[model samples]
Target: MRTHKYRTTDVAVDGGTLHAGVWEPVETIEGAEVPTALLIHGITASHLAWPFVVAQLPDHRVIAPDLRGRGGSHAVAGRSSMRAHAADMQALLDACGAESAAVVGHSMGAFVAVVLADTAPDRVTRLVLVDGGLPFDVPAMPDLEPEEVVNAILGPTAERLSKRFADVEEYLAFWRAHPAFQESWSREVEQYFAYDLVPVGSSLRPATSLETTIEDMLDLNTGSTLTDALARVAGPHAVRDAGQPSVLFYTVPRGLQNEVPGLYPPGYVEGLLAQHPVLEHHRFEELNHYSVVMTERGAAVLGGPLREAITERPAAVG
Candidate 1:
């Protein structure tokens, strides 16, 4: 029942403006030292994706941004890469005057958070990756073209980018019919869906750029920056990199459809965590990928762990 109040603003970045959602708590915490966390949304998503999560974390300041070439910045022109996205995060923090913040990313955003934490460690205090990171279990097929690779993994998301809807309402209807959000509809959901629409000629289409999305998809799979970031986070080259850090990674048992296995295939997360031994993970059997922030229950679960990640001390060196 927390009605989080927030303001929408745009900040100058490398290519174009990044539309951001800045949420402030209704009540002040005991200490004036406010902890800030940056929430990054998934592919084909916008800053609006974190409204429910913001509502739950009333004590913390949440900064969610519409990654370039999505939502309000749909026309943002730039080469999309995980490294570029991570740098934008640093610039965003500077613009917002936050010296450091916990970086949390959902889905593709998780990969960006990992890159940010590794590439710009001074600006990132912690990392919370929701439903992403550690890499998706994409098969290694040398014969498949990059486009083919993207289409195979992205599924409906890749197709939806180009499919134009008759109107905003029609686009919202499409989302309503989606298996992920079909059972979890609300005003907030509708608002988020509404923000996804953009006028294309006479028709309407999703605000995200299909090409940018595909490029990012490719980066998530084979980008060198991403691989390097993961290595550094796991203590590869740093001297005091003792294979530990304040990282929280959460995953839902079900996929976007609430039927498939999940974004992180079985054994993928466990093996990666075993190697890194720093990422604190929480798995939810009932929550789907989209509902992790879209639904109340999902937000509640995320809010609790997210609060601890931001305010609590890192686990004692073991």
Candidate 2:
């Protein structure tokens, strides 16, 4: 297997400096162009969430960013929304000198990827939406506020944002006992969690901002940006264009807690495929939502499909 060199760089964006992680293949041809893959992490996750997947792609340059309001970019000044996030991604691409890339996103990151493709179509070559991008079938509750909705959807994941830990080990212990990582635990996972902590007075807190997360979730679940973007790229009209980049959607059977019927339920996803045949669906029955991109097993299963997307040639137009 080929090895890679990893580094972190600061990308200038609208609100402030965005932090990004880049992985380059150790060996490259003297004059050949190397393809780039941009991986977006889920809500409340850092760029570290992608190291496992990065290991599986040895030939392409992989770029993963901590979105404006998360991880090292948490202090970025602005209202967090899908469109804003997309703009940051565009800036990151420019900073990396990539004209276009094979984009892969997990959870909320998938939503950002869709908007980036629609708003800046030329910057995206292909898309792999892992466990995100499609709208959820959330029931209407006119009486509920946005925070209530976020709490309901994210549960403990969102609550953790407001927590303060005594140290990195304390935070690590919390995740070590989580149901999602109980069976998939590893040293890499520990490092990912430790990177999430930021100093706050006498305590350390997760770098993700609660207000930003709430704003983003509200936009993703209730705003029209994603809905319109999905239509333009994967809707009936867009499907007719052979020049559009190929899109692949992968889903797992379980969710954050290893519960059945994951983020995209089987029947619901089938209906989505029926409505938008342009999207190709792949299912991994053994993994859950978190593991689908964070675990070695999940990354191994995705290596083949991701490589195919990266190297695939566009179909010849008639």
The per-residue C-alpha lDDT of model 1 at residue 4 equals: 65
TM-score of 1: 0.93
Model 2 TM-score is 0.96
Q: What residue runs in model 2 are displaced by over 4 Å at the alpha carbon?
A: 241-244, 314-318
lDDT of 1 by residue, 243-307 (tens): 34546778988886776688775588777677666667788778899998888888987887777
- Clash pairs, model 1 backbone: none
**What alpha-carbon RMSD in Å does predicted model 1 have with respect to the real structure?**
2.6
Q: What are the lDDT scores of the predictions, listed in order?
A: 0.80, 0.87
Error of 1 at 94 (Å): 0.8
Summarize candidate 2's per-residue lDDT along 1-318 as a digit string, tens digits.
646899999988887999999999888888998889999999899999998899888888999999988889988998999999999999999999998888899999999999998898888888889999898656775588877888877878888988999999899989988889999998888889999989999999999978988899889877588889998878877764555455788898888888787778888998999877778899988899899888999999988888887678733111
Q: Candidate 1 at 277: error in angstroms?
A: 2.0
